[model samples]
Target: MPKSVVSLWLLVSACTTSPSHSQSWDFELRVVARGLQVPWSVLWGPDGWLWCTERPGRISRIHPETGEKRILLSAIEGVYARGEAGLLGMALHPRFTDSPFVAVAYTVYSGFVELRIVRYRYDASRDTLLDPQILLANIRVGNIHAGCRFLNLPDGTLLLSVGEGGIPALAQDLSSLSGKVLRIHWDGKVPADNPIPGSFVWAWGLRNSQGLALGRGGLIYGSEHGATTDDEINLLQPGRNYGWPSVEGYCDTPPEEQFCRDSNVVEPLYAWTPTVAPCGLAYYDSALTHLPQFRHSLLLATLKGSTLYQLRLSQDGGRIEEVNAYPLGLGRLRDVLVTPDGRVFVSTSNRDGRGAPQPDDDKIVELVPKNQGIEDTEERSLLRLWCQERQLWVEARAPVTVRVITVCGHVLVEWRGLPQQRWSLQSLAAGWYGVIAWDGVRREFSPIVVP
Candidate 1:
């Protein structure tokens, strides 16, 4: 489907006992790009392109507006892709202009199957990624349940989630790299401040975590697949344990309750029975007009259920206040991406040895709100706003007025008719602020948390 606009309602439920509520969202899910061998990861690149990783060892850059794709690299050396194993996660450097680097995680076969994290240099002059630097390698992996997802911290550290590789016992082994979330420095060394000295394991006891995202205050969130039941979305903490083999989700069973008390186990924020196979997780708190219902929520994409699960967070970003489900016709959603503005995108995994594939078997679909395109075209295309170094930065192609307004409608920082600007918020208190940029007639809004 190309440029398909469909009206849909989000199914909201507080709990199993609570009655359901419906919120209408005028979202138009359309094909961004198509025909890929299991597009595992779809990341929005700093260079204004959609970067995608195909399971069969290929990375392509897709034009977001035109849906045109160009292969950056292909037939990655030593990739052993099979059932549930392949090139999976991709992440770009936070400072892409200064330090151009791209990181990827994939399964490789060296005698035995193993998972690996490699960093590639983005050569912008040639528009290609080169110079493969293997950061971490030789982690145990199997044909199935080989988890791989990446999240980059503001402090220049990287977090990766590893599956147990169908070996349930490995989840409890702290010495083993399998079934753990590892935090490592950019140069492949363990961070000095990591929970465990000389160890990259930040958290442990996961069956197959495929989704990783960052929420407010740098809180880490992950989604994992359970064996038969209890697919979970957990708030990951340093050195915390999530009972996998002994306990599926919460400590509902006697044995699991005992294991939890002894093992420092942290229960999942939310768990689902009949396993939805949640693959990709994204944190959304943008104040975009179209998707107001998704603010302060975690967007989860599932494989088996083919649904987008939105878990709304509380005011303090601690609890899940509500759970909402939106069904997209695309089968087996592998990954989801939320842009800085307000766009949401998901990659289809129908061709991944399961589900019924459509004419465009595997595709990256974009969710465009019905009332989109009302903003200034130039502001939408050229404005780049972000937070770094306790400062708010804004760049625009044309002259525009930028304002840093508090949640209570107080304008703190204002810049008029500047192509580029940066304002220090060091004196301001830590909380959420609205960044607004406008050119005379049309305005844009981006909600950001000042940490």
Candidate 2:
């Protein structure tokens, strides 16, 4: 592989240009949950909980109000989480209440890292995920460029975006599953209307598309991470080629123009130079009273840019009229979720080995209208702490034994503490540490950083 291809998987270029317009909506950000390790996906469940997946394959449901996270599965079976490869995307069945099926895509080690899609039964009564069923398996995957975002369409079909698995040649190969948007029934059968007969591929020629969304008139929209320049938001169509290795953004270059004319490659709806590393995408046309200006728009979360981008759609939803950027100061946002009532939530990815992890990094933050009254839900943390002036301030809701441990699970300081306490951190080195609190009945964990 070329050095540039490897750099695309490791390094991300930050976007510095200002958005087309200023932030028009008056919104305040609230921290919903904290101390997550590389949260890869987040879904606003119909049952009113936030379903999230970490890169290490832990499936969790977080209470949107109380910030309590309940782990359903500690580690998915046979998951290979190294670098960018791991349990990536998830989707609840369209009729989740009736079907109760949760579908997930993960990179599993089959000699080499390969991709697999599995379905599990969400057993609410048992408070666990049960009965794993392998829906699709044996797709090629790489450390990076393993595009695996999912969208459960209304017609009871699943749409998955597969990356080229770091091989540029595989993108144009019709027989390969890489670099394609695949359509399959819930049972893993090829959709009847798929362009390729007996094949799950709905569209081809893409390089590491990480986001998928459904727009007006049942149109599919996708966000892709380009190699260096030309991160794209594509209007996906059935049987269309997106021109991955041949063309980066448009048919502007002479060679690309020749390929575009010969291959009939569809250009992107919008492209960003300097590469923003666009990840999760959400379409917002809800009945929410707040942020009416955001109506009929698409919310995009970016890793390198570390900003939530709002692309206002045209009246017919076929064109992007304007692009605006909202920086919440949370670094490397991985996923964005928009609820039916227009509630917006984003998951941070600062701890993903590429960012500077601050104290209590990798949190899920919510965006609310400034006029809306946010209820002050007293956070019940077994142990929580923050740093200020080189002093570590620790707090506890109840009597508990707190242990300050290193990232390798080595205990550095162990003590019994009450509510509101302080410890000097001037002697400690700059690194990551874990603070654990045990109340004899339950245990809680949080991450702290020393600077």
State model 2's lDDT.
0.80
Please write out the lDDT profile of model 1 over residues 1-451, one tens digit for every residue.
Answer: 2343322322222211212522354565656786787999999988788999999999999988778898899779889899999999988888889889899999988887899999999887787889999999999989998989999998989899999999999998989999999999778999998888999999999999999999988888999999889999999999999998899989998999999999999999989987788999998875655467788889999986457888999877778889976656456899999888767889989888877665656888787765565322332443565455536555665678776766444568887766665445456576645555667633445445455
Q: After superposition, how far is residue 164 of candidate 2 from its true place, in Å?
A: 1.0
Prediction 2 TM-score vs. true: 0.79
TM-score of each: 0.79, 0.79
Q: Which ten residues in a row have the lowest lDDT in candidate 1?
A: 10-19
Q: How would you encode candidate 2's per-residue C-alpha lDDT over 1-451 as one tens digit per residue?
A: 1100000000011311222454543665667787898889999898999999999899999988778889999998789988789999999998989999999999988887799999999999988899999889989979878879999888899999999889988889999999999998888889878999999999999999999999878989999989989999999999999999999998899999999999989999899997888999999984556567678899999986456889989888889989986644456889999887878888988888887665777788787765457542235446555555546666776888887666444568887867665555456676645566767644455544454
C-alpha lDDT of residue 232 in model 1: 93
